[model samples]
Target: MCDDGLMTSPTHRAIALLSLFSVAQCWSGAALADRLGVSPRTIRRDVNRLRDMGFPIEAEQGPEGGYRLRTGGDHYLAVLDDAQSVSVAVALLQAAAGAPVTSTADSLRAIETLRHLLPSSVLSSVKSVHAASGTVDVGWNVPPDTRLIAELAAACNRKVRVRFRYCDSRGRVSSRDVEPLRILTTGNAWYCVSFDLNRQALRSFRLDRITELTVTTFRAERRDLPDPVRYLQQNLTETPRWPVWARVRYLAPLEMIVGEVPRLYGSCRSAEDGTTEVTAGAEDWDALAGHLALIAIKLGVTMQPISPPEFSDALVRIGRRITSFGAP
Candidate 1:
C-alpha cells in the first residue's frame, strides 16, 4: 500500500503515477518506488499494466532515464479520476450558462459528453450541484465577442496600449487610446478597466460598446491603482453623471444595512452612535428620497436625510402623497 491511504488501490495508484508523470519530465524507477513505497520490481509491473491500458508511457533504463508520458499525438487521452472529471463537468456547466471565453453551444456539448462518460453516482452529484446553485437572470446576459475579449486580455497581459472607438450612453462615438489594465465582469456585463491616455485618467469602458480596437505597439507605464472592482463601482455611483448626492442616517445598527445596501448604490459606514451612515448619489432629490424610503420600508426602520435639505423636502412630498392616497 502507498503511504497515502487514499491511493493504495492499483487503480488509484495508476492515476497518481500518471499525475506525477504529467507534471515532471522524467522519474527514475528507484525514485518512483521510493515515492510510492513499493519495490522497483512492483513499479515495473505497474508500468507494464498502464502500458497495456494504452497510455503512451515511455520508459528508459539508465542513471538519468526513468518514465515519462508522450504528448502532441492525435491519440491523446485525458487522465482524470471520477472526482476530477465531475469537477470539470461542473465547470463546463457554469461556462455554458454564460462565459465570455466559450460559446454556450460548445460548453453544453462538452457537458453532454461528460455526462455520458461519468458514472451514475458522479452524474447525480453534478445534477445536485446544478440544482442547488439555481440560476440568475442578469439583465444583460449577452457577453462581449469572445475574439474581442481575447484581444483585450492579451493587451492587458502584455502591458500595452490599445486604441478603440467607444460609444457612450448618449449614443456618441469617440476614439480613445488607453492602457488596458484589466478585464472585469459584473455577471451582467463585461468592462475593460483602463487608463485613458488622452483623458489622462482611469476609465472603465463597457466591452459591448467598444469597436475598431487595435493593439498598439506602445508600452504602457504602470500606475498605482485601487482595487479594480471598487474603482469601477465608484466610477459608476459617484461620478458627475449622477447629479444629486445625498447622505442618510439610518437608525438601525451598522450591520443591519451593510448587506442590504449594495455598494453600487452608495457607501455605508458605521456612525459614532452605532448607526449606519450611507452616502449615495442619484439622478435627483426625488429619486434619492424614494430610494431611501424603499430601503427604510425593507428594513422596517426609521431614517432621516442628512444633507441637501431638498432630500428632506422630497421625502415630505412623498409622505404627503401617500397620506392623500389613504384619504381617498
Candidate 2:
C-alpha cells in the first residue's frame, strides 16, 4: 500500500505545490509540508521535480528560508487547475457559437489546444457540458465588432464616458455621449446599458447598431439606478398601457418556458396546478395570436386564451392554418 501511494501521490502533490507557489510570493518547506500533509524532505523532492520541468523555482537559505516561482517565471508557462480549464473550455465553446467566421476559427483552435492539455477525466466533463449546452441565435447573423466590444468593456471597467454614433431601428442617426455602465447579452445580441448624458436617463444600446465608439478620458459620475440585469428585463417586457394585451395559460411548468421565450414577447408566471401563465401585449389581435401560436409551438403545450374574444377568434384562425398544412 505504501509503495502504491508513493507512485500515485507525487503528481497530485506536484500540482498542489505549483498552485501554492503561483498564489503566494514564498512558502517555507515546513509550511508546504504542513499544507500538503507531507514531510519537509518530500516537499524538497517535489520542488526539485518542478525545477526539472523548467518552472524556475527558487530557494533561499536563512531564518526565512523558503521557495518561490522566480520573477519572469510567468513567461515560461501557464498552468490551470481543473476548474479553470473547464471554465476556459466552456467559454471558448460559447464564444465559438456567437463569434463571426474568423473569430470562430480562432476560438476553435484555442478549444482544441485546451482539449489537448486538459486531463482525460476533465476533458470528458468539458465535453459533456459542451454537448448539453446550446446557444440560441435569435436570427442575429452579424457578430458585434470584437474591438468595439472590448473598448466598451474597458470603459465600463474604468467607469468612463464614451461617445458613439448610433442608428436607431427607424434609420435615424445621431451622435451620443453616455456613461458606459454594463454590457449585457440576451441570446446572441449584446446591449450596452448606459446613462445617456443628453437625455438624463438610462438607455440600452444594441452593440451592432453602434459605430465610431470613442472612450473619453472623462470619468463617469455614478448614478443610483436599478440593477443592470433587472433594468434590462423590465425594459424588455414593458409594454404600452393602451396596447391590446392577452392572457394565456399553458399546461407547463414555469421553468419549462421561462428563458426559452424572449422577455420582449411576454412575462411568464407560475399558476395553479403547475401551469404557466403568460401575459403579452401586441399591436392587434392578429399579432397577439401569432405570438401565442409561436409560443405554443416552442413550448409544445396547449394554450387556453384567458381574455379578449378577438384574440381567441384569431387563435382559431391560426389553428385553421395549422390544419390546412395537412389538407389536400
Candidate 3:
C-alpha cells in the first residue's frame, strides 16, 4: 500500500517492508518487491539492511522460499500508527491494573516509557482518559512468576523441551521434563499445558507452583493434539483435584450468580424451582462451608445446601463457633 506515492526514500521503503513483515508470517520476495514498487534486487538489499539492524529476519532459498520475522528475538521494535499507539497505551493501563505481583512493576515502567515516546498532543488525551479511569484489584493473591511465564511461552513457541520442579496440590514435589505446549490463564492464575515425557500423558501445571525451570535445547516434534483451550477447560472442570465437591442452591437468579462466580471456580445453572445451583470443589468440607458462608454474607441471601452430609455438618460446626464468639 505504501508504493502508492508514499514510499519516497529507501528508508521509507524499508519501514514499509518492516510493517508488512510484522503483520504476516512470510512474504515472497517477488510479492514484496511488487508491493513496494521496487526491483527484487532492491528487496533483497532491504532485507539485508533489516537483518543488520538486529531484526531476526529469516530468509529461505528457492521459488517457494520466503522471508519471515521470528518472535522472542534479541531486538524487536513494533511500528505503530497514532491510533495503534493509543490502543497500546490503553491496553498497557489495563494490564498494569490486573498484572501479577512481579509484572505490575514491569507494566508501569513500560507505560512510563511509552508515554515519553508519544507525541505531546496524543499524550495529553491519554493522560485525561487515564485520570478518569481507575483500577480495581482482581484478587490474585498467588500469581505465577513473570520470568517463568515468559520462558515457558518462548519454549512453547520455539517447540522445545523444558524441565521444571513442580509441586502438586497435595504438596508432593516432583521433577518434570516435558514439552511445553500452551500457556493459558483462568483470570486469576496461569497454567501450562504440556506433554509429560515421563508420564506419557498430557498434563497441566499451575505456573505458580513451578520452580527450577530450565529450557532445554532439544527441538520438540509437534504432536497431533486437541484444541489447547478445550483441553485446558476439560482438565480443569472434569478432573478437579480437590477432595470435597459440593453443590449449593442460591436463592438468586442464574445471571446474578454467574456474574458473582468465576467459571473456572464453579459451574452455575438455574434449577426448575427458580433457584440457582452452583457446583464447586474445595480442599475440605470446612473450606467449602466457609466459602459458602462468605458468599451468603456478601450477597445478603440464603443458600440451601444441596448435598454432601459432611459439608452440612461442617456448616453446623461453623455456626456454633460463631454463636460462641458472640457469647464470650
By lDDT, the better pick of 1 and 3 is 3
Provide the TM-score for each candidate, comma-separated. 0.52, 0.51, 0.59
lDDT for position 269 in model 2: 95
Error of 1 at 283 (Å): 3.5
List, residue by residue over 230-316, the lDDT tens digit for candidate 1.
777667655655567788999999888877665556778998988889988666788888888888999899898888788889999
Give the per-residue lDDT digits (tens) of candidate 3, residues 1-328.
3445755577877657755664565899989988888888988898898777655688888887899766542334345555555556555555666777534554555555445445665555445434333333223445545456556766887789999999998899999999988766554566788999999888888888999999999998778877666777777766666778888999988876777765545678999988899888777888789887778778887998989888889999989888899894
Clashing pairs in 1: none
Task: Write down the TM-score for model 1.
Answer: 0.52
lDDT values for all models: 0.70, 0.71, 0.71
**Clash counts for the predictions, in order:** 0, 0, 0
Best by TM-score: 3
| lDDT, model 3 | 0.71
Q: Residue 136 lDDT in model 2?
A: 38
Cα-based RMSD of candidate 2: 11.8
Model 2 C-alpha lDDT per residue in residues 1-328, reported as the tens digit of each score: 1233543498867756655664565899999888777888988999898777656677988988799766431333246665665666556655776678755665666555444445665666555444333333432334545445556766887788999999976577999999987766554666788999999999988889999889999999968987776766666667443258788888889998777555666678999789998888766788789877787797688888898788899999888988999999
